[model samples]
Target: MKPRTSMVILFLLPASLFYLALFLVPAAWAFYYSAFDWSGFSDTMTFVGAGNFIRLLTEDPVFWRSFGNTLKIIFVGGFFTFSLAFLLAVLLNSGIKGKKVFRALIFMPNVIATIALTTLWAFAIYSPRSGILPNFFKLIGWEAGTKFLWMSPEHVFWSMLIAIVWINVGYFVVLILAGMDGIPLEFYEAAQLGRLSIHYGVWKTPAHLPVGLRHCHWRDDAPADCCSQYRCAPPDEARIPAILGENP
Candidate 1:
């Protein structure tokens, strides 16, 4: 081989092997199991020949609901997540006092353990009778969405979505805040002094999703693919499977 070709091969070989082992091989195994009649670690493996796909399409209602819920998560969830993240980023970047403390407060939720988070939300906030949400609404006398059974079968999907959005907001807040930090302070200063719309330029962050989601989903890489389709996930990354309430 030419020296240039040899050098290229040397550089590409490790990445190629890694892709084959981690990505390609696992994908091939998934495909193999898709056609099987095996019950997860059973000794016997029967070839079912497209039975899984057929059953999912024809017989499964929950799968379709989960699929629809996934779609809701992608579009609705993504829209709200990005909007809230940008809104907070803009507010924080607007020369606010004690911004460091505010930033830490926003990002702290993403650092907490997912089990603790779910428990807190379930027991403290969504406890139906004496939850913080109901008490807060009662204090304000709004009485909207506070009376519903948040963890019920009917409301669980939206409850899960809201919880996911709330926890994941901090991750995107940190991400978009980092993106905003790159903007020249002069723009924000001018906006403060002369009152301009330069802040909009800082919020244009469609390109940041891949990097943000990849870093956020590093350990929990499975949702990286699924959520990348929707365009977001929490920073802790462990809450997704549990949030979806899926089982083996």
Candidate 2:
């Protein structure tokens, strides 16, 4: 039997109110404030209906550049991150030995403080003199590669994109893996009985079902993904299976 409308509303009401209180209301206030010109510290607000937006669009090269970077992170970085996560999640789920240990190792970067990761990337990985990449290039007799400055303006954005992808891929991998784990083992057994490759079934079947599509359901989680590149998981998020409970 279908749930009654009242029952549906009763279950959703608490979350709906929370969303309005925390997100929608604040967003509405921001949209309202966008119509005015006010130094956030000033007592006076000057009404400049759409003028601020006009200035942002026409008079701001820096704003446009930053906006472009945001788009790049969303599209370019997201593609690499999710693609790698899907491939790794599939491989990791293929009855690999020590899978739990591998998962923990992959997830280590996410749990670490972001500043520490940045420092490691800047000094140990990208540094021109003694960094890993430079030295590897040197060892390979690639002088031009050894001298390349990864932090330079020409390369910094891509470097940051790579770091963002590296830090966040593990979390998504774990998420996809969890979804795969939810699939009935009998499904795989049935596939095997039909002389079908289990790996193909795992990848192909889930892609059409809720398991694969779950990651695409909420793009608003972008804040969590983007900020995670620079911050440790929040306290509640650090609770292992508790965080996983949302997806489950």
Candidate 3:
């Protein structure tokens, strides 16, 4: 083999092995365990073949609700996240002052741990009695907002969706902003010189503009007061069985 080919294999070898061990092995184990009925505390796992899957699909109302919530996170959460991120990216890219400061402020949440961020939302922001929202509403004499129960069953799903969006929007803004910055200044100059419209110039940039125009597609969900990916979060009465136990 060529020396360059050998060097490429040496670089990729560790990552390939890491993926196989951490992701592939665990996923396979989860699939194997899904065929059984186990409360997760017992020594013996009962072999029920497709019984568990059948119950989840046809008989479980909680499963259906969590499934619906997942869909909401994919669609609704994605919409808000991308829209806000794109807007912020555009504003920042337009020669805004203190761009670095604004970028750091927006991305600060991502610098902190996810679990810590969730705790802040649950206790500091969403707590009805003494939380920020309630206190602000009370100060403004908005009685309904003061009395709102954000963590309550009826509102918890939407509340979580909002939190998830806030946590992820910053990272996407950075992504899209980098792409926008790659676009040549000549395009904008052409627009300013009346050789092209601003819209035409931005839209017509061949390579880099497509990266900026691409929509955010985030699949991971945050864990705040409940599991996002597992569909075990509340608003559904009962918990879904932990058969597979948090698969990626």
For lDDT, the strongest prediction is: 2
Rank ordering of all candidates by TM-score, starting from the highest: 3, 2, 1
Clashing pairs in 1: none
Give the C-alpha miss distance for residue 91 in model 2, angstroms.
1.7
lDDT of each: 0.73, 0.76, 0.74
Q: List residue ranges in candidate 3 displaced over 4 A.
A: 38-47, 189-248
lDDT of 1 by residue, 1-248 (tens): 89999999999999999999999999999999999988899999999899999999999999998899899999999999989999998899877999989999988889899999988888898888868987777788777766767888888778878888888898999999899899765444333322211232222234422243222233333332434444444655454333334342
Cα lDDT for residue 192, model 2? 40
lDDT of 1 at 179: 90
* Top TM-score hit: 3
Error of 3 at 166 (Å): 0.6
| Model 1 TM | 0.63
List TM-scores for all candidates, in order: 0.63, 0.65, 0.72
- Model 1 scores a C-alpha lDDT of 0.73
Residue pairs in clash, model 3: none
Which residue window of length 10 is worst by lDDT in model 1?
193-202
